[model samples]
Target: MHKFHKSIFREYDIRGVVNETLYPTDAYHIGRRYGTLVDSRLGGKKICVGYDGRLSSPALAAELIRGLKDSGMDVVELGLGPTPMVYYSVFELDADGGIMITGSHNPPSHNGFKIMLGKDSLFGAEIAGLEKITEYKEGFGSVTKLNIKTRYIMRLLQDCIIEDGYKIGWDPGNGASGEIVQKLCKALPGKHFLINEKIDGKFPAHHPDPTIPENLEQLAELVSKNKLDVGFAFDGDGDRLGIIDEKGDIIWGDQLLAILAQEVLAENPGATIIADVKSSRLFEEEVSRLGGKPLIWKTGHSLIKTKMKEMQAPLAGEMSAHIFFADKYYGFDDGIYAALRFLNIMQNSGKTASELLRALPRYYSSLEYRIPCKESDKLKIISDLKNALKVKKASFSDIDGVRVNYEDSWWLLRASNTGNYLVARFEAKTEKKLAELEATLSGFLAEYGYFLEV
Candidate 1:
């Protein structure tokens, strides 16, 4: 029996530092356990496997495939690509399920797996069940290697109808989205400039996460230097996106979602659109004003995806830049596809990216603030805060954590599902209100020995 670290089995996926909390043996065990679950519970026999550009990914994927074969589950090996490619392979090939070996915006020293069972992402309890493997199978299953890149690119390009003329910049940040972006750019009609297009596991250019404003600096410079219409950056596994406008300004996730929502609402009026709790309330107001129903749900990608499916929402997004479109495409988060959609909107609107985004009503908001805390204490702190809020009789929403709502201001403090930190955000009609909300939330945290600076 292989004993695995409990910390690796996170709420969303199995992830940990390589050679420390995670190893190839652990990957094998995960594959075996997941294979058993798929075979017995889901009545599935075949599974698709793919990996990212992380250095540890290929080895982990090999061991995982070995374990799956040992457990009598056939593997369709998608050699190397973004996480969404594995997801696309699952649907395009009509496979039972899929798994992508990726750290996904984490540092180079870390690696993990994003799993799916029958088109639905396994989360919370399903992910927890993978911590132990009690079942075993004897037969050896087959393995077939497949390259779905061309078909995947074609699918993305099919719906993208944009004329040739605009100047655009792309920065993959040396992550797994490089090769596909290179190919897609060739087929795209425009003056496309690319940087850090090589898929290197070391991420020599910078960390692939665009959510951090620092990561967008290079792309912003590129856009500014070239006077491009817009610039786009993708996360490590190409699920999340970041955008830079002509003025070298960062268009945040909610802002981008609001821009896309206009087009979606124009086509499908009164459709339900979902945004996570951490997103700006302006997104909710914008959606409602456009004749679309807005739903605020939990913050995790898996949670939001599941909620979108349940509500049959045409579009959904997060402050972290994970945008999902189900209106005319598969309901999965794909950075490349979202970029193309944004381009399509830009071409049709005849407005620069900044112009369209700046037209939206703005509010004073803070970037996501992560307060470091022990993983074990994260939930406890949130629980205590909830109790304290209840005693105060404050108006708040406890769907994910505690999002205290005011008439013209709001603040959110939630334990991050993927990290040992409490994530917080504040927004208000004015800077004064924003400061008051921040100070209020800060006072709450100070009681718990966690000091928040601004």
Candidate 2:
């Protein structure tokens, strides 16, 4: 009934439009196959399941759970919650693994599963492997559903709040986060303002992602309008954070990681901080300035999480708002946890968000530019662009995409792993250097035959 093949499965996770690439029967089959795989890999023989606020999430989660349980894997249904809550349930329950049904920041039609195997990100090829077991049409198992929301809530409150309370703003964007924000607010002693708290599958207010400046515009307004210290926005699934200061600036994902790592390194001297190539060079510099080692890793929550576990890094982040803290928590990316940590940092740092940004100046940066393309042509563009850059002898690293570092600035061009777009970022020390970096982009675009408006 399901198209059991690699087409639906992707590098980071399993994702596709509902009824097209991902159907209910497909979800059921994938669940069974996953259960079989878990049986062989993790002896715990149990799984935690959670879903986002997507239109198709409930059906997908139900059928997916049926598949997992049909393969003899016990299921703990976490109901509708953010992806981070599902991840937290996995770690706290001491289960073998878990799956968060989420489209992430994709459009309303998209939905997928964020996989975890023995507490590590089961992504890329690992996710692609879902087809192997389903090819044989594995046996069905039983699902025992148990609500774990309370346990999950308590885990978030565990040793999270700092000594002093702080005022804050929370915008769930009418997504799944509202399910728990009410419970979470009970533990924190702060004057909190919540917006779009309704768990609407349509995401009527705005796209559930905070990383995109356009998506976070409301939270920025909420901060200044409420006279709050800061505002926090979560993606549809709650694994990514979009932060807004009282002054209405989106304190990007990389910057938030820097702020968190600064707190971490003071306690654990010279600890490693991992960040994606999309992050500014200043992230590395800041980590080093604080006597911590910074490693530039590829972009993607799953990739960063795996690398964080491998390197045992205290902190890891992507510019898109996926921040991981291995030093104090279970190390998987959790936007809610990251928000709490930011508040804790504020309590300790004794500086407002605007003041912190004013003080931590280094380079002028451009927002991530997403250039659309056919998914089929994405790899070809990367290859062609790589060749073009090679002819110029411009120094570059394919760490995530092509990060060509220059004297005063750097430009990184890479294809998105999850979607059909070439994401690029540029940073420079001066306005002149910025233009130069932007100029280099046009040449690469022309060579690749991809018209990108800078």
**What's each prediction's TM-score?**
0.98, 0.95
* Colliding residue pairs in candidate 1: none
The true-versus-predicted C-alpha distance at residue 117 of model 2, in Å, is 1.5
Cα RMSD (Å) between model 1 and the true structure? 1.0
Per-residue CA lDDT of candidate 1, range 78-118, in tens? 99899888888999998899999999999999999999999
**TM-score result, candidate 2:** 0.95
Estimate, for each residue in 1-454, the C-alpha lDDT of model 2 and write its tens digit: 3455446688888888887777888888878778878877765577889898888999999898888766777788888888888788777878888998988878899888888887888987777777766443345455666777787778777757565456788988877788788778877787888888888888899888787788888887878887889899988888888889888887888888788887899989988899999998888878888899999998888888878878888889989888888876888888888888888778778998877666565798988888887888887877877787799887889877788888778998888887778888899999888878888787767765777687
Error of 2 at 216 (Å): 1.8
Model 1 spans with C-alpha error above 4 angstroms: none
Relative to the true structure, how large is the alpha-carbon lDDT of every model? Answer: 0.92, 0.82
Among these predicted structures, which one has the highest lDDT? 1
Considering summed lDDT, which 10 consecutive residues are worst modelled in model 2?
133-142
